[model samples]
Target chain A: MTRPGFTGSALDRADPIRQDPAALAAARADAGARLLRMDGIDPVVGPDGLLDWGGLDEAPPGAFLALLGLIGGSPRFVALSGIPGGAQRSPLMMELLDAWPPEEAATYAAARSLIDWHARHPFCARCGAETAPIRGGWARSCPRCRTEHFPRVDPVVIMLAEHRGRVLVGRQASWKPGRYSALAGFVEPGESVEEAVARELHEEAGILATDIRYLASQPWPFPSQLMIACVARTANDALTIDRHELDHAMWVDRAGVEAALAKLPGAPFDPPPAYAIAHSLFRMWLDG
Target chain B: MTRPGFTGSALDRADPIRQDPAALAAARADAGARLLRMDGIDPVVGPDGLLDWGGLDEAPPGAFLALLGLIGGSPRFVALSGIPGGAQRSPLMMELLDAWPPEEAATYAAARSLIDWHARHPFCARCGAETAPIRGGWARSCPRCRTEHFPRVDPVVIMLAEHRGRVLVGRQASWKPGRYSALAGFVEPGESVEEAVARELHEEAGILATDIRYLASQPWPFPSQLMIACVARTANDALTIDRHELDHAMWVDRAGVEAALAKLPGAPFDPPPAYAIAHSLFRMWLDG
Candidate 1:
């Protein structure tokens, strides 16, 4: 029998093209688009037609992105592509960034995360002086102290909980209204993903997770977060929400989620669409 | 009952203080260390005792290297601390690189891996241009392209196979005389760890694995690799070693491994010492 969880199909998926770097580069360069400078415009296409932030006049293009192999969604890459600009101006310019297709979004997400990291980190932490990038921007060396720094991607654990066939969802104050999603938190330095999962569940929903199973992972590039999704079985049903972290939380059964997805008349809440892991989990529960 | 496999303790634990930016900065400042000039050294430290065939300089002074976090056997972080004069030297300067604790060779292994990654990635891969270190040297960015690059750690699958009570292991061509370890290989893009485990076993020893279960993970930083360790139950036990990948292969019953661990004079070969995961796997076989 299949485990009652979503097995992550997004991380490792076979693709013929991504295997050949030269072919991939040729295809990308031929896409009839000016390689946008990451530091110049906020790579994301927002509500506006054009990104307002200053963009670079010219950039030396190279293969700075890690072409992460395709998952079910699409082939992805970590964008190391940058334009001669800083973070402060680019955020505003991102207002002009336009919506991207699925593949482009995935690629953009990876690129944005890498570029954003570069915009922020220009000095060595060890010596508090300027450093130089090395290893194709995978590393940096401190000029003053001779220390090196590498890019950092914080690991965040996200999970869906199934209790008596009802799924648990939490909404943060910063999220869209009635837009409850999976519970998540950063993995600490010494903590395992399992430990992080348990801690996040306990802190956000006051629910203790017992049987935790791996689901899937997504590269969330808003600032380079690896979202690890899991299916967690709840031990205690009693709700004890942490108001400081989550504004509200509840256990919505599969039928209720289906209704929300339908946008049924008079529905008080709605789950995100199929694209999100939360919605995927909800759909899985309904299918079961 | 636990399966016959590796023993992983949250052992070799270092305090979280090492990753603290403030503490690390303070330590470096107190040492009177100055940041090395980025343009001063060649990107690659060649075989000679110099970078780009340059003369050696004294190591950086007052620069203290803090232990970065350990992944499995790899320890990773921003920079290594050393005397200022030692900064420009080549192979001798390698000593200034972070070394793992004597008791924690695995941790040293992680450090080795990360250091190796830094060595390979010094330029912006995207534009093939120079990049700068950022985020306290944990990351790098291309100035022209504005792409950020972070150290990459690849994943590998290492597994021990069991059929009834017999455990399977393989010896690589370069392995020391009489030394044998579990079969392993890089996790190919689009392949799950489980799939990789099965493929590697089949390729190395022609064994088909069933019921593959993840046991533990170690950061093998030999060049930034994460060794996803697992235990698999073999579907059948007929021997067919792939000559190219394996110098030798066999199925050893529990008593044989136990005897090897006990250092019995007659044992053909012993696994890695007690400090290694291989030894732990061997021990688990005995216990089972």
Candidate 2:
């Protein structure tokens, strides 16, 4: 089973072709080359419910074209802040993902993440010098120190903790009123994914997770995160919630999980949808 | 089997305890708190080949302590550019790791990574304002925009690609005359670890890998990298070396891999030592 939001993309990231400045310029001059403009982190969506793609002639002056990839034989590029008019910008949310096909959704997610990275990393971390984009926007190089910096995709562990017949879940204070998800946290500097799973479970919900198993991974690029999903077995049912990290946490049996997974109309507490790894975990646990 | 290097550490990263400045101060003044000072990226290693841990009184004036964790019943902190005279500062290398136990080596790795992160991220990426350390050095917060940034651990896929009784290996131009290792590359913005394995294999060595299996993971904190090791089977054995990325690419039989792994007194080309995931991958492949 595949997690839905951003899995499919047909773009061929022709690394060698993009390296040639002349070739890249030729692609930009081609009428078939599409330009996707971003306003901040959101892509400008036209009234047709899709990203407004236009030719280079229509692009604003001084627009820096960040090559996305080749869609079929034509090149696709994304830019930050150069939408002409008549289009509304929107953040990539669940509803938008649901309305689009997987391939288009994945491409949009990739573009948004790259655009966000470029916006933030304008200066070199090592030398405090202004950096310039290189390798057709795949990397940035500090001219002073010559340090090449690539886009950052932070790894996060999201685990479904099971003890006997129950699954452990927790709700964050910032989450919706009755929504709970599998315990999740970023993998720290010097730790494995399994270790992160155990540490996060214990810290957030006081559950001692063991027998950790890697289930799957998804590109959860809500500003670039790689969600590594796992199934962990916990021995203790008791949870001493760290109130600072979680609002509430508890053990829910298979039936309770199934009820939430059903997504019944007006259900108070809802499990994550098909677009999230949490929903995939619940379905896997229930099937087992 | 546990992978060697940066896997064993008994320190309880008491994150909750770190949130309270008053409690952290109390821990600092408790006399049981031990401080390990780092000069730039290297930790202060004593003549006895161990981190010289001492009380807060031993720390230099105006030294800022980054909390490592509670080792046993005491808090452990690491400072940068704080140690005064006598001790030699060194990077956490394989020779040093060979001298120290796994626990100590891992702790040093963690401390060094955190220290390096703090050194580089003095400015905010979001607002272009100076950032201040928070969460006891686990994170930094921008004063202007209040955006929190955590230490980055980039995920890299290092794989032993096998085709019909031989393993594929390559060496870069910058490497020593005859040092080769498994094909490896960093995981990019939008791909799974498995997909990364396939992509990197094709890109570097012109091998189409299939049936990818997760072997193990190790923390290679030469400024923070998580090496995810895997074993992939390739049906086609043809090699088209990307000269720009690799100096040499070739297939080695089981006997050749065994000879390299043995590190015979004056071997021409040797596999990495036990401290690296590349060595572990070689061992696993050799054993099979």
Candidate 3:
């Protein structure tokens, strides 16, 4: 059983300590407090090709801080809201996961999501007032309206939509040639996981999804998304591509799927990379 | 098998209509367009004791409109952001679920969640710009910053933690007397569902949970929330209640759970209502 990426984090995420301002301040002042340096939502790699770390002293004056729980016995932190979206962040995040250890990669993912949210949400959505970061950068509060804001992890359903024997896969024009992945869309405001699955299937492709089953989930922290992996049976396998969403979509049989999964050349289409939950979804589909 | 409340709706959620302004305008101008009336976040019951609905003519001038998808090919809309949060919304929402049929109830839940989110988000969190509702109230756009906003459905983990032969249950101070349910907490930005369950169980009641499993999900619309249901095995049964969060917590045995679930007199605790995911969680636990 291969574990999905960004799942098993070692941090305790000290929620009680977040509630106590004094305790948080004490943790920041502790001798073992460490900082994860970043470059515009991307983790900065040290000379050793690992996540760059320094003392709390490295955190700039008045810089917004994100407490990444406690790593071992040391309080790990990330300073944010300084370098906001100046680089290509999505690709960099995926690249980071490959370079670091599993727990360290998850820690970095947490830091990136927290920092990105804090950077983007300097003002309140309710009152348009400049909000202050609270709960160790886990939440924000507006001075004018006193409305508290927490970082949002948008839920998305990535489906391996099966019809008869073939499974549906889609390709975006921007992706590398011949590369395709599972159909996915964000879970809407007022929908259950199953409802979102059905809706997205209808919206993205001209198919109706039923018998939706939740397989697994992964934390995708490219600006914070929770990818809920599922398998759904589709009645109409006929591909009516919603061009606004996907460049192309088709029903691929088991041979093509197996070839793509094995990374063989001339396999009709390339599978999603290993770090992606779509890759895991494919594995789950094949295994089941 | 009993289905979770708010899990199914009859609406199409007309994403394509939302993208086409002309089509949406045509729908609004259509003689068949229906408006679901609301009274300060609560649905106004008609003379017949059903959801009060009127024509597009009844939508107040300058009222923010939420397109509650297309109900049986006629666009069902809700006028909102006018009467926002003056009543006891949570209880009213629960009451609405009991009164309406499953599909109608689900539609009401969608309207409530969408309208409430639209009401709260008058401005942008990214740039504090006063945003305009677009996509028929499905999304908002900030003209000043060119940023788009979508209604948020906060994810929460509701867990039934098993230890030995008993399950842990907790109660908040504001809840009705003698009522208890599974421990739940918000899934923070950087956490997975399993991680959230473990963190919440540890934070709310000093317990270590293992074998965490995802069972089901439900849309809980008081404001807006997606409750992810789970059951976990805990090594420790000794309860340590977080006084700041819960009034009390205890490990209740199968006999106690069965009695409470049966609503027997003097059962020691009242179970959560069927509308709540916690109620379903306990039922699943018992069946398993």
Candidate 4:
């Protein structure tokens, strides 16, 4: 099994109900239906430090309710942008990554991504028509053009480049002090994951890589991205960083990575947290 | 490497130039800028059966030109709904999959997907405002909402299930006679790829799977999808077909699959074509 924040859920996405308007309405009225509310991207949490599943009566009007799935014979819905004012909300998504169990974290990730999509897509891109939530908020349908829009999940290639017993890591300009992670970028329209890996490595650090191998995938819901993790073997170690894309990049030996992972006193940089695929990739390389 | 139709292109997207309107206008007049026109979903082909890269001078007015990349120091663009009246056009995307080389075929796939996206998304989904093509057709921006919309690629799980030396294959209700392929479905909003594979297997064929492994992936541009190919081992082989989803599902031994692959006289059913990831999975299982 992958580490937490990757993807694992107990909810059975009863998708057939999504197409049935009457069934969806009935689900909303069902007493067993639980509501997971979101205030913008931040999830509303109860005093117990878990997702506050509130009653449907407490949800605000015009809130978009996305049917997450049937968990234990109860239909669960995630309400976006409809929290009645004065509800306690948690911090941003990254901060709440580990606050819940794996299944609950995955649920929050799904709800957050869906909510983000709904927030961004309110009009029909097909004909400048207003699109209303349909199919239990799993889809948006344009009233004029009749175009149905589903949620989007962008594929990204995040790779760990190993060369001569050292792994290449880069720090983005926006990251905190002394923080570095694997080189990553969005997969372009026409490229394979392998091609994306090679292109990102060369573009970000001026390193040419071969022997690319896919590791695993994690669903990153900082707005619906599928992080396809990979490892590549590089022949050259010299670095030419693109200042526009990265602040700095360098090769770190196993000991250095271990120190960073352990947060030793003299570690050169802080590695990504255990919730990230970057951390998994680093650990895999160090252990292998 | 993965099977053909997965991905192939060495073109540097040079995406930064996409934001520069001056660069885009210059490319439009560069004489070397070749345009691939699409009439709806079909590419305008020349008499010689190649993608007709016509001169920009002949393009129709108000054509949506999607910048593919800088191929060999020249820009390549795909124009949607702008084929000249006299040019010969291919039937549709699926029919022309094998007409071009692997790289060119991959390019056509990308172009077709982008064109489809442009055709469907003409308005902003956020505020019901008209959206204009921006970033060289890679994205659309709403004039009122200031929201940017990018191309979407949906993820699907296509898996081959094997148990006791017999592989499971199913035929969808809509397929032609004697055609059976791998069990496949879209990955739901919250589940991992592993969960998708298992869920699809059980939902479609009443099989419980274990030992799920990712084999390969293909960019299936039948309206923009990323086909994630996998293989799983089943603990029990009892077959219970869901009539709504599949007409029939059965386990085939190695000899049966080999016979079908070879097109033997007494073969029970026909497998998927070589261009499909289903064919690759079957080939891998048989060869291994």
Off by over 4 Å in 3: A85-87, A90-93, B85-87, B90-93
- List ranges where model 1 is wrong by over 4 Å: A1-288, B1-114, B285-288
Second chain TM-score for model 3: 0.94
The numbered model that scores best in DockQ is 3
Q: Model 1's CAPRI class?
A: incorrect
Candidates 3 and 4: which is better by lDDT? 3
* Cα distance off (Å), candidate 2, residue A31: 4.2
TM-score of the A chain in model 1: 0.70
Better of 2 and 4 by lDDT: 4
Per-residue C-alpha lDDT of model 1 across residues B1-288, encoded as one tens digit per residue:
232111122223333334356754553444333222222221233354222212112224543233443335343333333223212335432342222222233323333433444444556644556666554444566788687766555556678899988888778788778887777776543234565677677766777889887654444433454555678998999888877668888888777887777778877566764434566556655665
Better of 1 and 2 by lDDT: 2
Question: CA lDDT of B12 in candidate 2?
Answer: 84
**Which lDDT value does model 4 have at B227?**
80
What CA RMSD would candidate 1 show?
12.0
Pick the lDDT winner.
3
lDDT of 4 by residue, B1-288 (tens): 445564765466767668779998887778899877655567667777756677776667877677887889888887766322212235565566655666767777777777777777676776777778888889988788577778877778899999999999999887889999999998756566777899899888889999888887777766677888889999899987878789999899999999998989888789887667788888888888
lDDT of 3 at B87: 39
- Encode model 4's per-residue lDDT on A104-142: one tens digit a residue: 778887887777777777777667776788888888887
Tens-digit per-residue lDDT, A1-288, candidate 2: 554456667776666766888988888787799887555556566678866677766555765787888888889887644332212334465567667766666787778777778777777765567877777778888888787878998888899999998888889898877898898998888787777888898998887988888876767766777778889998888888999989988788877887788876654367875777788888888888
Q: What is the lDDT of residue A281 in candidate 3?
A: 88
How do the residues B106-156 of candidate 3 rate in per-residue lDDT, one tens digit apiece?
777888888878778889888898998988888899999899998898888
